[model samples]
Every structure is written in structure tokens, then in C-alpha cells.
Target: MENKDSKSEMIKSMAFRLFLDRGYDATTIRMLSRAAGVEAPSIYHYFGSKKGLFYAISESYLEDYQELLKESMKHWGADPMNQILGFVKFAVWYTMNHIDETKFYLRYRLFWPAELSEDMEKHFHKTNDQKEDLLRDAIRVCIETGSCKVDEQTAYRSLINFVDSCTFNIIFSNWRPDEQELIETWQLFYQSRIKLGKGDFEL
Candidate 1:
């Protein structure tokens, strides 16, 4: 018999593939148990329910992104604009590299299941709220340093709109732009929104 830790990992591996392949709503516990060669109760024992399992999968991705965000933010630059650009660059990198996870996470976030547990739902929202706060803090820093030409709110809105537009295109297109395309997009947005000079950033 598999030990508890190995069993949990086994279940999650199969569950991620199933969720990505069949989607959240269609994949049943019976199917998961069959795919993992485990009993249905084993899944409940490890994850509580389907939604809980999906949350575990999402947590894996979110935690990685959060760590990358924290580490990247620290080293991106001492300046606020660099941090903002770093944020966008990281999004592009993540979207390109983790396309499946990004799609699954975005689907779950955009169309949350009605049956999802309230705790899981709240945690997901809280995680995203913290990210938004982080971005807003960078924008606020630019306002304080007088580096940004616009108000903090406008800068934040513009940056978010740019990020969202880029994400939307990449996700819907099923792939991202090349590095130069992404860099040029960021440069254009930055000049239009924050920078007084139209010159591209050193990114």
C-alpha cells in the first residue's frame, strides 16, 4: 500500500491532469480514483472533496507565483518603475511557461464553482488582493518619488489595464508574444501612462 504522503502526491498528479483535461465540472471523484488507482475515500481523506483538491492544485501554483513575485520584486530594481515592469515581465514569463496552470487558475478564478467551499473561495480572493496591493504599493512609490507623471490611481489603473490586456491576449490566443513584442508593449504602456520621456526603459 502507498504511504500517506506518496498517496497524496499521486492523487494530486492525476487530479491536475484530469482537471486540465476534463475541466473542474466534468471530472468526478470516481474518475479521479480510477485514474490514480486509489479509492474515492482516499481522495476525501487527503483533500476533503473535489473543490478541496482543486484548491490544493491551485495553492501549489499560487504559492510558487507568490514566492517568485516576492523574490523578483526584491531584486528587480530599487526603483518603483522597474518593479512595475518586473511585475509585467514576470506575468509574461509565467503565462508562457505555465500555460496550463495559468489557464486552469484563470478558469477557476473567473468562473468559480457554485459548490466551492467558502474558505477556499475567500483564500483565493485574499491571495489576489494581496498581489493587487503589492502592485498598488509600487505605483504609490512612483507617485511619492515624482517619477510617475500621473496620479497613483491613474497609474495603477493604466498598469492593470495593460497587464490585463496582455494576459487576455496571451490566454485567449493560447500562447504569448515573443520577448521583443512583450518588451515593446510594456514600453509603450509605460510611456503612455507613467514616464514623461517617450524613450524605452532599459528593460
Candidate 2:
């Protein structure tokens, strides 16, 4: 069972790298099998189809990303501003460190075959809602604690758009901002636009 699990993980890892490098339309089962050092049938045995493999990879990557966000929230304590900043920092660092996963997620998150589109959309939204809830909860605390004065819906949307924009600029564009630049950008957005507090929140 352990060996089977290891082999399955190896296949998924290779498939993820290939999907990241070559994209979903370009990557083939032969490429994945060769890269994974496994028989072509084994790919079917593990994932049923290329799309299935892709779905599995997406699911696993999202799960890991969610856990990282949760950890960032936990590590930064109850201060809403600090939690938000910590999550942003962690997200920027994670994107740089896990370029392939980031690329895969950004590019292919909404791309799916017609038959799987509904299911994929539901799954994606479910995960996204969980992530949004974290931010919404933090913003609610901010409002309650007098850290910031913003409606939860508006604040959450702005924060989401801000983070997505920052991440998109970092990953998809040629001009890459360094760690400090990314951190500062996040801080500036909150401090300037959101008017998070009268004093600077520790980043």
C-alpha cells in the first residue's frame, strides 16, 4: 500500500510539473508516463484519464494552499491586520517558491472540459469560499475591534481583488517584484486605500 501510494504521488508530481511546463492541451499521457517512469496503463490505473489526473492535481494543490493559509492565520495571532498581512506575505513567498503550482493554479483553475465544468466549478467555488471566509472573518474582527471601519463584503472583495492582482502581476508578468516590494505593495494597499488604522500595523 505504501509503495502504491508513493508511486501514485510520483506520478502526480511528474504530471503536475509537465502540466505546469507544457500546459493541459500540450501535455500527453506518454509524456507523463515517461517522466514518471511508469507504464502508460499505470497512469490510467491511477487517475483513469488525463483529465482525471489534472483534477486530482488541482484538488491536492488547493488543499495544500488552503492549509498554508490556515497556518498563516494561526501563526499571526488574532490581530486582524496582522493576520491579513501575514497571509499576504505567505502567499507571495509561496507563489515564488512553488512556481509550478502557482502557474498551474492561475492558468488552469477555471479550464475544464464541458462534462466536468459544473463539478469543477462547484469544487473550485467551495474551496474559494473557504478562503474568502477567512478574510471575511478577519475583516469582521477588524471592524468589531476598531482596527478598521469597512463593510465586510466590500472589504473582502477589495482584499481579494488586491491580492489576486498582486499575485497576477508577480507570476504572469515579466516584471517581478522582490519580496520586500510585494510586502510593501500589500501594506500600502491596506494603509492607503483601506485606512486600516491610525498607526502602522506590523508586517
**What is the C-alpha lDDT profile of model 2 across 28-144, one tens digit per residue?**
899999999999999999899998898898899899888877776678987778778877777777777777788777776656645566777776886688777778788888888
Clashing pairs in 2: none
Global lDDT of each candidate: 0.79, 0.77
What tens digits encode model 1's per-residue C-alpha lDDT throughout 69-188?
788777787677777788888888877787788877777777766677456567687668866887888888887887788887777777777776777777786646787888787777
Query: Candidate 1, 110: how far from true, in Å?
Result: 0.6
- What are the per-model C-alpha RMSD values against the true structure? 3.7, 4.3
lDDT of 1: 0.79
TM-score of each: 0.85, 0.80
